[model samples]
Target: MDLQTLTYIIVGLTFVLYIGIAIWSKAGSTKEFYVAGGGVHPVVNGMATAADWMSAASFISLAGIVSFVGYDGSVYLMGWTGGYVLLALCMAPYLRKFGKFTVPDFIGDRYYSQAARTVAVVCAIFICFTYIAGQMRGVGVVFSRFLEVDVETGVFIGMFVVFFYAVLGGMKGITYTQVAQYCVMIFAFMVPAVFISIMMTGHIFPQLGFGSQLIDAAGNSSGVYLLDKLDGLSTELGFNQYTSGVKSTIDVFAITAALMVGTAGLPHVIVRFFTVPKVKDARSSAGWALVFIAIMYTTIPALAAFSRVNMIETINGPEQTGVAYDTAPEWIKNWQKTGLITWDDKNDDGKMFYANDARNEMKIDRDIMVLATPEIADLPAWVIALVAAGGMAAALSTSAGLLLVISTSVSHDLLKKNLMPNISDKKELMFARLAAAIGIIIAGWFGINPPGFVAAVVALAFGLAACSLFPAIIMGIFSKTMNKEGAIAGMVSGLTFTVAYIAYFKFINPEMNNADHWLFGISPEGIGIIGMLVNFGVAILVCKVTTKIPNDVVLMVEAIRFPKGAGDAQDH
Candidate 1:
């Protein structure tokens, strides 16, 4: 059968499975909707959390980012995964013991102020929207290629699928659905990497293949390391060595810190811990998620190396010169239809050339690299189709998680807890569903018109979280004297400063986005680290001048810090 037909069958089956899970797990109360009745198993929640954590960025964009940026992309690796370690070790168990339904709920009650909750609601909504935009864009990219549809149409279709399960299942449905998605995503990701690894290096494992010598066409050693060969090929095309980095030391540190702290502060990821029945289960889930996440993360660099090698050879031919444009392979023609791969013959030689200089004749979008890898490697038809399914699973899983945060922010944080304290449970549930649907439409618009590439846009969202939420959560848990005035002031100042800097460089004045225009040579993607410091400093300064914390609030903080057993935290 043709690739397209096989893709429809496999992807359709997965959709049916998701829809069925949603129906079976449809949440009946606000508790189930918000935290899956707070009875989810650690192992099950771990799989779901891993799916939510990976998102489109890990599955679709990480390898692509690594392939193009070379060594600089290591920041993402360290930042994202390291941030999870921070979350697991320092925050997850304590937050679960805090017994709050959402981040805003914790901030509000911990700070003993409705205003603080409101600020958290705004920050959560903004960060989630920023992050969801990338997932939706990833969805559109996958659909446009495999389904032969325009990006906007693909986004609209994706919105329907995500909204259906999200609105219906709430956390209950999304949790189970994401577990299934994790399976599909991991399976889909590993199959291609294993195939390409054996094909290129004659190794069974991609991790070993990563450092092993390349096998020549005749199944013999080529006497060249993969990175060494890639570096040589890169120099021939006037590009920097594939293993080198260009980002400054400070920028690297700043971006890595931002991503790490941002991951810790993300509202959606934190809420996963609340789904488990006990604080200990939260810790267990975090450990399992790390195990699941590490599998995919370890394979990424190898895949990036393999993909870079395959793509360069496919486009420029084995001679390291150029290939005739008219005779370009089906992958180019297919991707070109989506307007992602562009070719212009500057030399009028009818041959395509890729380089880091003005002689470059092709504009290939990084988003296509992972999706196009199977096709470029001449994998079987079903394997190619499986990638499309896998991409959808990755994008939809995270998108659902983000939409849940947005909805809960509106319904539970803003309305039920603040605006309509007397609202009925049934009515609040309805509003939550309504909020989720509206979030979907708005997120779809962002997907249709993303500000940047998937990884970059997602990185900016991380910065936002780092700047606004991390300090508040940390101090609220660890510091008894962190009053509401301090927390509110810190979040506002940090968010405002980070947003203005990112908007100025990224949107208002694109020409001034260079290092000369940056603060301490930190790009917008890394500015959140500065923002987070601003938050910490402002919160501390404001706290010293404010009234002392009430004795009861101090006890609450102490109880949260030294928990005795699962679900042992008292309601404040």
Candidate 2:
């Protein structure tokens, strides 16, 4: 079959599967809509959590970024995966014991204040919307490339699909759909990596292939290592060495810390813990989710290395033998039409060389490397179609998760809890569905007109989460003295500082366009670290100044932490 036909088939099949699941598991009650009726098995919930946590940024963009940026991109691999350790160890079980529908519920009850809950709802909404926008963009990109539609039309199509399942299924529907999405995305990711690894290093495992020796001309196995070759090639192209530090050590450390904390604080991820029946199950589920995520996280570096080497080899030749630009393969032509990879015949010799010539520089869009891999490697059209379906799965799964969180916050936390305390469960469910539909429409608009790169936007979302929600949750769980005043102050301070810093550097600054952003010499990607520090500092200071904690709030905190005999606390 042709690539287009195969893509349509794969995408259509996945959509049908998701809609079918939604119809089968249509949520009838508020509990069912909010937390899948608290009946999801731990392992099944773990897979669903993995799908929810691993967003479009992870599935569609991480490897592509690493392929171009090389080892310096290890921060993403380490930071993103490492955060789950914190979630499992420190947050998940305790929150599960709290038996709350949302992160704000934990904060509200622990702090003994509706104000705290409102603040949390604001933070959750901000984080989810910012994060969802990127996923929508990922969906649009996949549709445009594989389905051959305009980006706007692709986004609208993606929005409708999400609206259908998310509105019908709620968390119950989204959880099962995410399980399917995880399978599709992981399979798509691993298949390409396995193929590329075997082609390059005679190893099926990409991690092993990344460190293996390169085969030289005459089939002589050289002692030159993959990393060493990559380092040399990178510098030749006016880029940093693959293994060396392009970012300051402090910046790297801070960014990693912020991402870890942010991952723990994200509302959609935290809410997944509520679905598990037991507190211990939540902790175990986190570990299982981490293992699933690590399967991809560990392999990404290898994919990056192999793709880098392949890209360099294809664009630049060994010093002795060079292929003419006119002789470039069919895959090159296909990608070039997408304007993702373009070359000019430098020196007018009709041969593209890997040299630092400003006028003759070859431009390659990093996003294309992963999406175009099957074509580049001469794999069958079905594999390419699988990739397209996988990308959609990744994006749609995450969007559904985020939309659920947003809708529930509005209908359950804000409207039902605060405004209409007498509202019926059926009315609440209807409002939740309405909120989800509206959120999907807004998110779809942003996807069609994306403001920035997928990774950058995700990082900013992490920064917001890190600054606002993380500190409050950590202190609420760990510190007995943290008051409502302290929690509210911390969230507002952290969120404002982080968002303002990002806006300043990303939009307001003249010279600090993404490439040049630095505060105390840290890039914007790493600035979340600074924002997190300020949040913690301000929270502590405010707490010290107002050292009074309510007696009831103190008791609530104690209960959440010491749930030894609490036999599967009922979800409120």
Candidate 3:
């Protein structure tokens, strides 16, 4: 089949599978809608969580960024995966023991204040919205590439599919759909890696091939490792060495810390624990989620290295003079039509110079590297089509998860809990569905006109979560004296600080948005670490001045800390 036909078939099949799962797993009650009736197996929930967590940022953009930035991109790999360690150890089991349907539920009850719940609802909504927008944009990118449509049209189509399942099946449908997505995305991701690895290094495993020596066009093996060749190529092109980093160590550490904490605190990620049947299951599921995530994370480095080498080899032959424009591969010719890869013969030599200097004849967008890799390597058309499907799966799964969180925050926390305490469960479910539709529309808009690069947009979402939610959630679980006033104040302050910083840099004054203008040399991506510290400090100071926590709330905190009698705890 042709690429377009193959993409339609594969993407259509996955859509049918998701809708079928939605029909099979239709939710019947509030519990089912919000937490899948608290009956999901740990492993299944783990797979769903993995699918939900990876998003388009991981599936499509991560390795692309790594291909350009080299070792500095490892911050994303480490930050994203390491945060699960904090989730499993510091948050997940305890929150599961709390037996709540949502993050706001836990915070509201723990702080013993509706005001706290409302603040949490606002934070959850904002955080989920910020994250969902990027997912929708990712969906659009994939759709545009595979379906031959503009990004806006792709986003609308994805929004419709997501709305159908998310509004119809809620958490139950989303969980099973995400399980299917996990399989589709992982398989789609690995196939190309394996093919490219074998083509490059005679190794079936991409990870091993990344460490193996490069094979020349004549099939002669060289003593230089793949990374070594990549570094040499990069340096020759006037770019930083591919195996090393250019980011300051402090900035790298801060960015990693922000991502780790943000991953732990993200409402969508945290809510996954509530779906499992037991506290122990929550812990086990977190580990399982990590294993699934590691599969993609570990492969990213290899993909980056392999793609970088392939790109360099294709453009600049070993003799140093670049290929003539007419002699470039069909893949390069094809992508040139998309304007993602372009060439200009500045010296009128009719030969391309793919380098980092301004006079270089070739330019490639970092975001297109992963999607373009299979083509760059001259892989089968089917692999290219499979990648398109995988990108959509990644985008759609995470969008559904975030939509659920946003909808639930409005229906359960804002309306039912704060506005209409007497609202019936059935009526609330209707409101939740309506909220989800509206959220999808708004997210689709952001997707069409995304604020920044995919990964950068995603990084801001993480910063918001790290700054606003992680600190409060941690204190609520671990500190017996955490009060409503303190929690509310800290959440509001941290959220405001983080959003303002991001807005100023991203929108207000783009000219001044650099390390020189940053506080402590922290970029917007790493500013969340400072915001988190401010939140912790503010919450603790306010807690000290406020009246002591009620005896019941203190006792509740103690109860969540242990695993015993967790099965009997009532979900408030």
> Quick one: best TM-score, which candidate?
1
Instruction: Return the lDDT, model 1, position 290.
Output: 96
Minimum summed lDDT over a 10-residue window in model 1 is located at 563-572
lDDT of 2 by residue, 1-572 (tens): 78899888888999999889999999998888999988888899999999999888888788887877766677777888878788888988888877878887778778877898899898899889989998888787787777878778888998988998899989999999899999998998889889877776777888888888866545556787788888887777677778877766877787778788888788999889888778778877887898898888888888778777776677666551345878866767766665667777656777766544463457777777778777776777888889888888988999999999999999988887678878888999999999998999889878877875555667788998888888889998999998888888888887888778777776677356544446676766667777777878888888898869978777878888885532342434
Candidate 2 deviant stretches above 4 angstroms: 215-222, 317-325, 342-360, 452-456, 512-517, 565-572
Tell me the tens digit of each residue's lDDT in model 1 across 464-500. 8999999999999999899999999999999989988
| Candidates 2 and 3 compared by lDDT, better number | 3
Q: How displaced is residue 76 in candidate 3, in Å?
A: 0.8
Which candidate number maximizes lDDT?
Answer: 1
Candidate 2 has its poorest 10 consecutive residues by lDDT at: 563-572
How high is the CA lDDT of each candidate model?
0.91, 0.82, 0.87
Model 3 ranges off by over 4 Å: 217-220, 452-456, 567-571
Q: How would the candidate models be sorted by TM-score, starting from the highest?
A: 1, 3, 2
Backbone atom clashes (below 3 Å) for every candidate: 0, 0, 0
User: What is the number of residue pairs that collide in model 2?
Assistant: 0
Alpha carbon lDDT at 369, candidate 1: 83
Compose the digit string of candidate 3's lDDT tens values, residues 380-420.
Answer: 98899888889889989999999999999999888887888
In model 2, the clashing pairs are none
